[model samples]
Target: MKAEFVCTDCRKQFIAEGIKNEYTDPVYGPCVIYTAECPLCGGEGREYSPNQGGDDHEHGMGPSCPSGGCCPGCGGM
Candidate 1:
């Protein structure tokens, strides 16, 4: 099955195939979940599929370097 997730912070979407449903909390009972990295933000978490194509580049998603040619937050100097 294909699983989809959307990053709330970056508003990015990603899709994954052959998702495995595994229980995270053993004590909390059976709770199947799929964990994957966000293709747009590269964040280690859930990712969702896109409703349409061409939206990926349109939103400038992903952890791409800024136009300034440097990572301001990471101090890429």
Candidate 2:
């Protein structure tokens, strides 16, 4: 089946399909898998399927602020 997941490194959205080997950590077993390049930074990585659709800074969530609000970590300038 096909699914939509966001890149943890880059907040860009993308679709993953044709995933044959969704298993990782043989002992732990296979889980959700991604088989596409990140749409934002073009990086290759994997994350839990549930982590999709979240704010990602490494992928450039925003330069300054999202909505005139302070950053979660740095607060504000």
- Please estimate how well model 1 matches the true structure, expressed as its whole-model Cα lDDT: 0.54
lDDT of 2 by residue, 1-77 (tens): 35565555765667764254555677787665555557678765343365344455334355535544455464432
lDDT of 1 by residue, 6-45 (tens): 6555657666553566776868987776666666776654
> Which candidate leads in TM-score?
1
Q: Once superposed on the true structure, which residue ranges of model 1 sit more than 4 Å away at CA?
A: 18-21, 24-28, 47-77
TM-score for candidate 2: 0.37
Residue 39 in model 2: lDDT:
64
Check candidate 1 and list the clashing pairs. 4-47, 4-48, 4-49, 5-47, 5-48, 14-48, 40-62
**Backbone Cα, N, C clashes tallied per candidate:** 7, 2
- Could you estimate the TM-score for every candidate? 0.39, 0.37
